[model samples]
Structure formats: structure tokens, C-alpha cells
Target: MKQTMTNLKQLIRAGRGIVPAHTVIVNGNLVNVMTSEIYKADVAIYEDTIVAVGEVKDYIGEDTKVIDADNKYLVPGLIDGHIHSECSKLSITSFAKAVVPCGTTSMISDLDEYISVSGLEGLNEIFEEVKASPLKVFWGAPYKTPYTFPQSTVSYNFTKEVHENVQKWPECFGVWETVREAVTEEDENTLGAIVEASKNRLPVFGCAPMARGKELNGYLCSGVRLDHESYDHEEVVEKMRKGMHMLIRESSVTHFLKENIRAVTEVNPYLARRVSFCTDDVTATDVLEKGHLDNLVRLAIKEGVEPMTAIQMATINSAEAYRIDHLVGSISPGRIADILFVDDINTFNVEKVITNGKLVAENGRLSYELRAPKRSSVLTSQLKCKKTTKEDFEYKVDIKDGKAKVLSMNVKGPFVRKRRDVVLDVKDGIVQPDINKDVLMVSVLERFGRNGNKSLAFCSGWKLKKGAMASSAAPDDNNIIVMGADAEDMSIAVNHLIENGGGQVVVADGKVMEFLPLPVGGIASDLEPAEIARLENIINKAANELGCELPEPLMYMFFLPITAIPDYAITDVGPVDCIALDTFDPILELMEN
Candidate 1:
């Protein structure tokens, strides 16, 4: 909050006096966003704050500066409720250059790709950049296990080290998206970290799906300040009733845009203002093609939402929820000069944008700032696999006798679906792939630490490729991903990953087709978003080479180990029941022998 206050004071003084002050804006609809009203005025500005805003001359002096705004419409600068800076496939600097021109002046970003650890010095570097930049960036601490989980048990992934650092540093606006299974009294590391945040008055975020009564209160008591995972509209109201801030999400994973707009304003009426909007995960490619906040704002309007209400969801409501309300959410005198000029208020299409009092974009075209990227320290990652062979992925499920029941685990939705214990006949001790059921082999390997921890299981969903469809998803490229029609193809996939050191790879019928060498954290590319997306497309084709028809290969690529959001999933050790948090029968129908 000090950040907001300091910036506010700087703006106040900067507009106080001088050569017509620095600059002036004249003759436009000065959007009095403070009350959702708009009025015509000859606006005057000095530096980054409005000095005088009224008809003709309300407070203008002799040496007033001005920019002709004859027939233009002005509104408060936009704020994205939540997004990831890393997901844009760019450094903070690069991402800013790209989006600023698109009129996104501020964002609450949760970059899980960057791990906060023992030193936390590196993480602080990024935080400092966020504070000092032209585009305001709000940070959220990562709740994801940086290099653990989905491999076997939740052990070795998250540790007390993260808790200790957060207890001391508290580098983010708050903790983001915590799972119940990831926390416990025995392992109160993250739990304690939340307590520390609460003591320090920092917000702790949570995701309690369909939770009620005790479960809901339990989550709030644990320090979760807000919830973005409330899917049902009733649950959204329930959370608000419980005094927890409700984050209405609209994204690829969950679509709740129109629903929330109706629920808050139409259905509940009283708690309308407590709700907000967010797109949890948007890739860099989508950032370029569809637009950032443009997509959501347009969707709301198209879906019959009031223009003012939609803007509030993206701007004012977000600011208040993050507790930075005093700094932004309006075009008042002391607020930062992040304003948007749109042609039409109802349609809400932006024609010009001013961020920090400088022109960032005009029309739909981005006035991109192609400069050197802001660098952060301590980014070290690689893919490691030794002597990978087709035989490594091959297994005989037959136990002594020709026929024995098998175990299968599966999840249905989210990234972590459900676990099942089904037994199937195993011939020659090897459980064969069930092409009819969309069940395929899956595995998760240790990437960062040198434990060589490899867990294996069977999953359903990929409609077969004759060979292995494999990828090493370390974002740091520290481990290999190998899955295929047979052990022979699986080995082929692993061998290619082994050769690349770290990246995504696919092998079919003994032929290497697609590979992405993400040697740095396996999640990011040193290259630009376009380049990475092009390779990602090739990887998509390779998934089709294995005869699968999914929207994006990476979605499936990510599903291999997500343990919370229920889905039929396979890990390095075995199939995981996300709800149960345990291994199940491979087939998940017949009893395990």
C-alpha cells in the first residue's frame, strides 16, 4: 500500500505547478469514474495527474498547458484482475512492452514459473522491477510445488524452506491458489507461512471448490484472503456471505463470465460489488492473438452485461480486492494517469490509451517498446536423462499366471481429476494399452534435484500414436517425459529428450518429429512467444501423429501430474486418485491382485 501512497504523492506534486505544468488535455468527456458517470470538460493536466477538469475553465490559470481532446472519450486506466507475466512467454519488460500498447495498464500477476527459495534474493529482483515499472504489476506468491508432486507422494516437492522464506520476506501481495492436500498439521510449513502473512496483514489466497460450512470456514481460518476457484454462482454468493472475497474466473479451464455478471448484479443485488473478474491462465500466443483484457471486456458486453459493470469487474473491483483501491480504479486527481480513450462507451472499444501519463497505444495497434529485457538472477535449469532406451518404458503386467487383475487411476476434470482401482487381465505380466478406452501410459520424473526419482502409471485420454508421445515438463528441463504406444516408442521419446538435455519431444514409429528444447526451467523459452508457439504447433501435430484430437497438446502435457483438480491421472509411481490422493488399480475397475 505504501507503493500506492508514494506514487500518489509523486503525482500530486508533479501536477501542482510549472510550465502549464508539464502537459494538458482539453475538450473531452472526462470520465468521472469515481461515480460511474461521464461529463464533458476542458480537462487540464500537469505531468501524470489531472490539474483542472471542468467546462471551459473551472480552475485554469494564465499559463495552463493543453492537448486538444476535441470529441474524444476518456475513462480510467484498465486493470487485469489476475494473469501471469511468465505466461506471456516474455520477461516482465518484454511483456510490458507488448501489453501496455493494448491498454492494459495494471495487472495482478501470479508467475508460478519463478520459484521463491532459500535466498529469495532473485525473487526480490523481479518484485523490485514490478514496483518501479510504468505498468503497475501486483504480485501473488506461488502455491504450486516448484519441483515436486505427481511423481509419487507429495513428499520432496514442497518444504518448510518456502514457509521460512515467506515468513521472513513476504515478497508478494499474497499467497495464491492453495490446495487442501498440499497442507497439513504434520507439514505446517506453508500453513505457518499463511499464519505469518495473516499476522503481517498480507492476504492469503485459496481455492475451495463446492466447499460449505466447516470446510469453507476452515479455509478462511487458514489465512486464505480470497478464492478464485468458486465455480458455482451459489458458491460465489456463499463466499461473499462468509466475508471472503470472491474472484469470478473466466478462462480456458473454467468459464464463468456471464454467470457472475448476472449473479452479482441481477440475482444477489446486495453483494454485487464484492465480485470481480479474472483469467487465470493465458498463454503468450493468446496474449497476441485474442488480446489481454480486451477479450474479457468484449465477452461481457456481448453477453449483455452493462459496460460500466464490466469495466468495474476488470478495474475498480480488482483494485479493491487486492487492497490497492486508494491508488487506482479512478481518474481522480491523485490517482496514477492510467486512462483509456474509447470510441464508444457501450461497445467499449479502446481507441487510445495513456499509462503513467504517456501514450502507450492508439486504436488496436500496440506501440510496442522493443527494448532490452529486464534480467533476473539465478535462473538455472536443464533436462537430464542417462541411457534412455525403448525397453525402459516397456513393462510386463502379467504376474506369474497368464491372467491377473490390473490397477488403473483416472481423474475427470481440472488438472487432477479422480483415482480409480480397476483390475484388467494382464497377458505375460504386461498390461496392454486399452485403445478403446482412451487409456495410455503416463509417467512423471524428477527434474530439478538429482534424485532420479521416476514414477509410472496408466492414464486415459490420449487416443494412441503407435509410438510414444513424450515431453519433459520441468520448465527447467531437469527431467524427461516418456509415454508411448509401446515401451519401444516410449524409450525413443526418452532418448530424444536425453539428447536435447531438456525440452518437449515426440517419437513415432522410430521417427523423431517434434522437439522443444526448454533448457531453462522447461516452462519458458529464451526465444520469443511466437517462436515457442510455432514449435508448440509442431508438437500439436505430433500428438495427432499419435492419433489424438485434443484442443492443445500442452493441456494434456500438463495433466500428467496435476494432483488436486480431479482428472484420471498417471504419475511416475502409479495412477493417482486426485480426490483420494492415493494410487489405485491400473485398470481402475477390477480388483488389484
Candidate 2:
């Protein structure tokens, strides 16, 4: 309270010109996101707060540093409504280094991966690291961990007590993405976490992907107010009409902005108010090759959206949705001095960036020195599972000398899989993946040593002619997920990850093709963003050369164990029918010998 009053006094004094501002930007067109207008103005900053935004000649002093904007457009720094910093495969500090220069001033994360891997203590270690970054990071205490109860294994679980304990932290903005099934079923832990967040006066973020009608209503009744998983424009419109804030996501694999933004461009322009932007899960290569939220804003403008509306979606709308508009989201007085100088609104080319009244990035590169904090030992890889063998991945059938019918998973796209029944010839009671049918064997191993549990299933759609790809960075649970046309290569890929702590590896002809070690928590790396991007590019290319055709194949395989999406998914719990929550035997029937 004392600091607030003192800061208010300083801002008032600086606005009056009695106390000179620390920094001043002269001759720039201010894009007023709140009013949807653009006008020429000068901005005066008192330390880290904007004190004035109109004519500020009087606020200039000999010691005040003045920046000539050269008649460029000044817009509020961008904000990502929802993102998983871990998906970038970089430390939080390194993630900031990649995004802060792209004009992303703030981000909100669920920290689900960190919590599942290292628990409450690891979450705090991440918070301590955030302090060293120029980017502002907010947290949402996850309602549950291991994503699915008893189905997926993890190092820690987000119980009711864990939710209550994390809610006491000032950094926790709300409960994060309560599982759709949990909310629909009125699960006690999910409801309890929501109640605790409500008691603290915080909003609950949602993860109801493809939810409609009564199910969506039930989720809303549980107090989930935000969503980033709307599949299309109709879903966005329905959720918006239901009073839920929709975050249009443009991730590496899942692209919904081009289709979802139509709720504003075609359906009802008024719905734009409830719309914002998020990067839910992005790779460092995407951030380096393309921009972050700024890229989304540009794509929206090109998709028939008004430039001002798109900018608003990336800034004020997200800030207001997260209840942090007063702190950021605008270039108005009394807000944090996070601003971007752009050449045009149509192209959204950010020429310079100022965060906290300091010049940080210029010409697409960070201009200031940034050093990430040392990682705690708790963040290292927790993979305690033994090396896998080829026999472990063998698909066994009761029939010894005949063809067997099996229910295999056929991946349709990035997130959807369908159960496909395929008849394969069996030899010695063992069925091998049929390369002629483009079917490959997939397996998930419990890497936490909680159980040396390993589940095997056959999958199609990777189109791998030979060899294998594997990683210990599997999502929802950081176990080991591997897929291959050859059992020997699959064994090599999985063993390589085990011997090197944890990483993504490609194997062909019994030789290691490419490997990217995720030494930090087995889900993130401590390397520079460019280096990570380089390794990811090479690894994906290696998988392509081995005959896998999907873009970002390693990333797609990483989510095979995630049970949140749709149709079919496989975890260490064996093959799961995602829609029905039922586990079934891979072998459907055996032919007469």
C-alpha cells in the first residue's frame, strides 16, 4: 500500500512536468486500443510507468533520454493469453529471449508439464527464474496432473491440497484448464480447485475442446470462463455466445486462427471483443522463423480482419480477459511502459521495442544483455526406467501360425485418431508392423520408474517406410513414446534417450540418425533458442528422410500419449478409446491355424 501511494505520487508529479520523466518518445502515432483510434502523440515514461501520452515537451529534461519514433505507429506490446513455455524446449529464460525480441511482453502459462515433472518445488524454481527475465509470466495452478487419473503416470499429481497450496501464491492468476471430462462429470478435485480459486476471486481457464451444448454448459457452470481450444469458427461463436472468452490459437501443429477468426470477420464483428490470441504450444523454430503473437496479429489482418481489431485482440483483449489490463495492455498513462514501434499496421513490422521504460529489442534482435539463472538440480531428467529391448515392443497374438485381426490406431491429423482393424500374418505368435500397409508399431514406456510399465500398440499414418523415432518428452506425462517400422530401430531409439538422460532421437538401419537432448526435466533444454531450432530442424528432416512425411513428426509423436484430444490415443495404460474412456486389447480376433 505504501509503495502504491508513493508510486502514484511520483507518476502524478511526472505527469505535471514538475518532475522530469526518465524517458520520452516524441512524434509517434499512438494506436489507442481502448478507443480503437490512432493519433499522433508523445509518450512520457516515469521510470517503468507511462505518466503521459499527449504533448509531453514539458516533461523532457536534460537527463531524460528521448527516442525519435520517426512517425512510426506506436502499439502496446503483445501478450499471449495462453502458452506452454515448456513446449518451446528451452528454459523459461531462454523462452523469454526468443519472444521478448518478437515484441511479446507478457505470457500466461499453466506450467502443467513442470508441475507434473518436478512438483510444487519445481514450480517455485521456475518462478525464481522468471524474475531474471524481461518478459512478464503469470501462472495458473493446474487442477490436476498426469492429465488423466490412473491412465497416465507422472512424478507428481495436482491433488486438491496442491491446488489449495498454490492458490496462496500471489503469482497464481487462477485455476488452469480444468479437464473437460472432470468438469462434465463434476469431479471432486476439479470442483474443489474451482471453489478455492473462486474464494480467492480468480477466474478459471478452460480446456473444453470441441465441447458443445449440455457438456459446454456443464463446463461453464463449473466457472471455466476462458478457452483456447475452439476447433473452428462455429465453436468460437458458440462459446462466445455462452459468455466465454475465446483465445484464437496458432500453434506449431494446431492452426485455428485462419478458421476461428472468421467469427469476427464473417459471423459477427462484435464478437471480436471476446476474442484474443494464444500460442498454446509452439516450437522455438516457429518463433525464430516466424514471429510469436505478432505473427497471429498479422495473419488476422490478412484474413480480412480490421488491423485495429487484430491489434486489440493481441493486446487489450488478452490483458482484460486475464484481469491485468491496468498493469499492461495499453499505452495509456499509469500503465507499464511496454510499447512497440511499428512501421505499418497492415504488415505489423515491429522496428523497436521498449519494456519497463528500457530499450530491449531493435531490428528483430534483443539489444540488451540477458543472462538466465542457473537451473536447480530438481529440474534435471527424472527418467529412471531401464533400457528397452526389441522383444518389449513385439505385438503378440494367441494364434501361432495364422493371420490375426487387430485394432490399430490410424492417425487422421495432428490430434484425431481412429481405430482401424487390420489383418496381418503372424509368425511364431508374434505380429510385426506391416510396412506395406504403412502401419508402424508405437509404444509408451513409464519413464519415471514408478512402474517399469510398457504399453504397445500399432499405428498407421506416420508413413515411415523404415527405422524409428522416439522421445522422452511425451506430453501430459513425460514418459517415453516411440514409433518405428522396425523393432530393432525402435529399441535403439528408446535406449538412446535413456542413456542420454532424455531426448528425441531418430534411428535408421540400426544407426542413430539425429538426437536432441532435453536434459532439463526431460522436456526442456538449456540451449539457446537458435541452437534448439537447428537441432529440431535436422531431426525432423532426418525423420523425413527415413520416409515419415508428416510435418514436425517428432512433435506429433510427442503427443501420442496425450488422452485429452479425441477418438483414439495410446499411453502406458495401453490403447485408450479417448471418447469412451475404455481400454481394449490390440488383438481383435485370431484366424484358424
Which of the numbered candidates is closest to the native, going by highest lDDT?
2
How displaced is residue 200 in candidate 1, in Å?
1.3
Runs in model 1 deviating more than 4 A are 1-11, 18-20, 41-70, 85-94, 116-125, 128-135, 143-171, 180-187, 372-377, 384-387, 396-416, 419-428, 474-482, 567-574, 583-593
- Candidate 1 differs from the real structure by a C-alpha RMSD in angstroms, to one decimal, of 4.3
lDDT of 1: 0.61
TM-score of candidate 2 relative to the true fold: 0.97
In candidate 2, stretches whose alpha carbon ends up further than 4 angstroms from where it belongs are: 1-12, 15-18
Q: After superposition, how far is residue 114 of candidate 2 from its true place, in Å?
A: 1.6
lDDT of each: 0.61, 0.88
Please write out the lDDT profile of model 2 over residues 1-593, one tens digit for every residue.
Answer: 12488778877898788999999999999999999999999999999889999999999999999999999999999999999888788888889889988899999887888887888888888888887677888788888887763357888878777777889988888888777887776778888899898888998988988999989987888888889898889999999999999999999999889999989989999999879999988999999999899999999999999999999999999999988898899999889899999999999998898988889999988897787767778888557898878898888777687887888888887888888899888889888688898888999998887878888988988889999999888788878899999899999999998898888999999999999999888889878899999999999999999888898898888878878878778888888878877677888888857
Per-residue accuracy of model 1 over 1-593 as CA lDDT, tens digit each: 34578655655554454225455566678766557677886555555665545643433556655566666777777777766555434556556655665567888765555552112544566666565556777666655454223334321243445654554454467766665555532236567666666766777767666777777776667767677766567778877888977777776545677676666656675564666677766555666676667667777778666777677767777788888776677776656667777777676777788776666677665465444334443443334436555545544542633443444445344344444444444655566666665556666665444556666666655666466666655231223456666777777777676666556777777888787775434444556556766776778787886787666555555545645555454555555555566666553332234
